[model samples]
Structures are given as C-alpha cells and as structure tokens.
Target: TSQHFDTCLGCLACVTTCPSGVQYDKLISATRHQVTRNQERTFSDNVIRTLIFNLFPYPHRLRPLLVPLFIYQKLGLPKLVRKTGLLKKVFPRLAAMESILPKVTVDSFRDNLPEVIPAQGEKRYRVGVILGCVQRLLFSPVNEATVRVLTANGCEVVIPKSQGCCAALPEHQGQAEQAKALARQMIDSFENTGVDFVIINAAGCGHTLKEYGHILADDPDYREKAEKFAANVKDVQEFLASAGITAKLNPLIEGDLTIVYQDACHLLHGQKISLQPRQLLQQIPGVKLKEPVDAALCCGSAGVYNMLQPEIADELGVQKVENLLNTGAELIASSNPGCSLQIKKHLELQGKTVTLMHPIELLDYSIRGVKLLRK
Candidate 1:
C-alpha cells in the first residue's frame, strides 16, 4: 500500500481517468501526511528532505544559494564539470539535480513588481495574484508575464506584499500542519484585498490553492473562509478566457512560430483545465498551436517528484520530450514551472533547442509585439 503511495506522482491523472469519481487527490494527500508523521527514513533521506523543505519554501533562504549557482553557471563551470564527470563520480544525485537547474537571473520578480500594477485600460476586474515560493525564486518571469497580461487585459493586478507561499510544497509533501498554517496566512493576506479573483500562473500552486477548502475542512474557524477562498481561485488562463481579452494582440514580428502546448498535469488533471490555455494560445496571431502525443500524461515534474525520484522522473521526462519533439514545434508552452524545468532539462540533454515558456508569456509577447527569444 505504502509502496504504491511512495511512487505516486500526485499528478492526479488517475482522478481524471477514474469513472467512479473517487477523490484520489484527497486520499493521497492524507496518506502522505500520515507517512510524514509516522514513517522513518535514512539519514541521507532526512538530510535531503530537510534541505529541500527548509530552502525551497523560503525565497530568502533559496536566494543566497543561487548566488554561487549563478557564478558557477556564468564561469562556465557547469560545462567544465560535466566534461570532467566530477559530479557524476563524487555525487551522482547532485549531478542529476544540477543538470536540471534553471538559469537564475540577478533580478527576481520580487525585486521588480510594484505593490499595485494599474490596469492598462478601463479596469474591468480587480485581481490578486499569488507569487508562489519556487515560482518567485526560479520562474519570476512567469509571474511578471502574468501581471503584464492581466493588466493589459484591463485587470488591476494587486500583488500583496503580505502574501507568501501558497503552501503547495508542504501540502504536497505531507506536512499537514505546515500546509494549513501557510494556507491560513495566504487566506488572511489575500482575502482582505477584496479582489474579484485570486490568480495563479503555476499549475501546481493553483491546484493546491483550489483545494484549501479540503485541506482546512476540519478547522471550525477556517472551514468557511477556506471554502470561499478556494471558490475564487482561478488559473490565469481560466480567468483570461472567462473575462475575455480586452487588449489588442499583435502578431509576432518574426515569422510564424509553431508551439506545442504541453498540458501541465495539475492544470489538466488536477483542475480539469485543458482547453482554456490552448484557446488563449491560439488567439495569438502568427502562432500555430499543436498538441503532442499523450498530452494528458504527466511530464514527471509533479511538484518535487523530479528531485526525489530522479530516475523515474527522467524516464517520464524523456518520453514527454520525445512526444514534444515529434510534434515539430519551435516552442513548448506549459503553465507550470516544474514541468517547464523538467522538460527543458530533458530537451537539452537530448540536444534539442526548443524553448520552454508559460502560455501567458507568449500572450505577453504578442500583446507587446515583441519577438520570443529562446534560452
């Protein structure tokens, strides 16, 4: 029983496939919580888990570590180290992790975004955006793009300074108390803003946010509040599609780019949001939307799955990358950061040059009439 649970990606793909309408998400979450509380682990496992939980959930803690990583990348140490096979010989797991590490920029979105970004035109909706933990540190551009696209479409984007992690990390890892605490903090921070909707760009964060009601169902004080909070939670794509685009979209100045939309498991399986993102992508001029084979299958990023289960994660990522490459697209658009990182690393390993980006980023490019640059 625990064996299956241990290997489970928590991608919620089975939930969508099941005909009985079983709540596997809730079941798996509960089991994970029990494991965290009762299960024992090796010293190495504990150290790794501690390092990840302590650092990744806190931007301040994670930022300082990036400085050395940035320097390493800038000095071309990554290539040199790979060539020497030093990491593979001394620390195989670290090598696997280092291979997938995304390029970190000096300026993070936290340093750039103002408290309030006014609407570009007449304000139709006042929206609050959640800058997730890992998203803030690793994929700040996605949050920045989300705000740009939202404001361009006549939405007043309110990014509360008080908002912290959405507790997706802890909840997914089975730290129930920590997850609840963070959830409450987020609720207190965002609910007071009185925004029409709380928008999230990362699919994993959105899924966890929308399940706050279930996470806090046992809390008498927060049960109603959590439910109300969850009700307003919307993926950026979902919100944009429902609200309709008010801004004019310009075609890519460069030639038409064929994009393969890789459905983030959280978006497709967890939230059952499959079409809205693709619809938004198709709306962009000079953009050709193509679907990869097994579009519904997980890219194996399932939160921290890539880090914890690298071998299995890499296998699934390779398969996903193969499907994506077969589509003959110039770029891969995914809503989740983890999926982006996983897919990106595998593509690079396979000597592929396809760009990985969030759907909103493409929309932002089209809206601003800018050329999409590959990394």
Candidate 2:
C-alpha cells in the first residue's frame, strides 16, 4: 500500500493471483490514481523479458544452436573450458546446470552400440525401435536391453537408422512447426518399412510419438499419416505387456528383492500406463513391488526440466527421495532415462544405497537370470 501511494504502472500482477477478483473494491482506485502519475515505461525491461521467453521454450526452432553444444561435448572440450577459464563466461549458467545434467557421451548409442536381435529360431512379430536424439546417445544400453527382451520373446527387430529424433524435445515446448517437420521425417521412415510396431524405450518419447495425431491435427497430409503412424507407437513395456504372450521369468531372484517404483509422469499420465509395468514386475519370482506414496507426482526430471531448471528439479527429486526413504527399499526402478539417473543421484546423497534401474533392466534380469547390480 505504501509503495503505491506515489505512482504505479497498474501492473496488477495481482490479477493472476486473484481467485474471485475481490481486490477490485480496495485497489482499483489506488491503482488508477497512480497509473496517471507514471506514464514513462521502461524499454530495457521489455527486451529482457522477451529474450528470456524466446530462448528456453522455443527449442525446436533453436535446435541448430545446440549442434555446436553437442559437438563440444563430443570433442570433450569441457575440460578445455575449465582449464582456460573460458567456462566462467562462455556457459556460466550451463556450467552450473551441468552439475546435474550428464555431459554428452563421447560415444552416442547411435555411433558405438550395435543393436542385438534375438536368435530365437522362430521369428514372430516384426518391430522397429525409435531411439530419440538424446536417448539415442546416453541410454543406449537401456535400448539394447529392450531389444534383448523383445527378441527373446520371438520378435524380429528392425531398428531403421532413419528413425531419428521423435521431435518430442520440441513438441512439449510448443514449437509445433519444428516438431511437425521432424515428426514427418520419422513417420516417412517407419511407415515405408511396414513394420507391425514402432517400439519406444523411453515412455516420454512414446507418449509424444503416440500424440503425433494431435501435433499434426491440422495438416491435411500429415493428419492421415500421423494417425496411421501413431497406431504403431508403443512403449517397449506397453508392447510387452499387451502382446498377450506368457511372460517368462527365470529362477534368478530366489529371495524377495523389494523394489519401490518411481512412476514416470509420461508413462502413467501421458500414456495412461500406470498398471502394466507394475503387473509385469509382479511376474518375477520373489520380487516384491512396493508403491511409494503419491506415485503420480512427478520426480521433477520431466525431459529437460532437470537439466534446464535444476533448482525446481532438485526440489522435486529430493521430495521423491524422501518418499522412497519412507519405503525403506534398496531398489528404485523406473523407465525414463533421466528419472532413473536423477532419482539415483538424489537418493545416493542421503546415504541410502538404493539402486535406480529401468523396468526393462528388471525384465532383462528375469530373462538372463543373472544379477547385474553394481558392486
């Protein structure tokens, strides 16, 4: 009230805060009296606000700028930046942010890893896996594990090299045009092959790929293509669960390994796939599936949130760890790559030696009948 006594711009940031607009009776006259007093508007403030909004959310249109970033990480120039003091100025924010964000791998899954198809003397359903840009890099092993389980179940896997970015990075950011163009690229490559399904290892990408119909809803050509293409989009676990085949479990886990699951928001909320993964886990011998409280709340590592907004992500991650702590379980398994890592890191800080795993990893264990825990 004292600040408004002299003059104001009537910004009324309170309008967004008001539940019923009851502020009208007391503040409007005071605000109007000040609006007449201060007519000079600042130009620099507008420029700063516009620039902040333009940079972060418009990623699809801005992906070109990230090429150099990926290149630097690939070349391992972060060391050069640190040694030369260039990091302080060049990427001050990113340098701070990188504490949580894993550096780009020297070998992206696409370049170094070879995808394996099962040697199951019987070839059954043919499917292709869509490895999104980031997942194609960091979580290659998880994708590889996905293929192992698929092929073990008599699937002839065909991972088309052309099945590139799912455009999900931009789709969620409201950069629809950029996402559509990339989506068209992915649809053309997979549709041409006439595969039975396009399995997605990451739940987030699967959800986005499944929603290509909505992304291209207005496009005359793309709408039809996306609809047909989306019919094939399946998260690996969803495909496995819905395949109507008897799931196999080896005699590996003789004793109960209590696992508290952190459900990925994209898997549960985005794809409405809350129960399938849990049901699959129940099939394992002596495996106890423990549900953490409020499993629906996000672990805060939604796609790029953990990387771009570390503070908020950290808050959420810590909260999730608290929930896991209450369960007193040693294993925290999830499907999404970022969530596995973020939850793993936060839980580790609390001196609780919890193992964060991909649900696909557990399926891999049940198939292989060998424990792969890090000693």
Give me the candidate number with maximum TM-score.
1
Q: Write the per-residue lDDT of candidate 1 for residues 1-375, one digit (tens) a residue.
A: 544666899989889989999998998999999988888877766777787788887787788888888888899888888889888777666676787888877765246789889998788999999988888888888888899999999999889888888889989989899899999999999867879999999899999999999999999999999999999999999999999988888886466889999989889989989999988988888888888898888888888888777778889999999999999998889889889989998888899888788989889988988876644
Q: Estimate each model's TM-score.
A: 0.96, 0.74
Query: What overall lDDT goes with each candidate model?
Result: 0.87, 0.67
* Best-matching candidate per lDDT: 1
- Candidate 2 regions off by >4 Å? 1-96, 103-119, 244-247, 251-254, 373-375
After superposition, the stretches of candidate 1 with alpha carbons farther than 4 Å from their true spots are 1-3, 373-375
Model 2 agreement with the true structure over 1-375: per-residue lDDT tens digits = 423432221222344346885643125433433443454434543343244335433334334545676787778876676557565455543543444444444344135434435435577788887766656555666777777888788887877765667876555533456678888988988876657888998877887788788778889988999998998888887888888434467633556788887788777756778788888777877778888897776777776556544566778889988998788776777888767767866765566776677888788878887764532
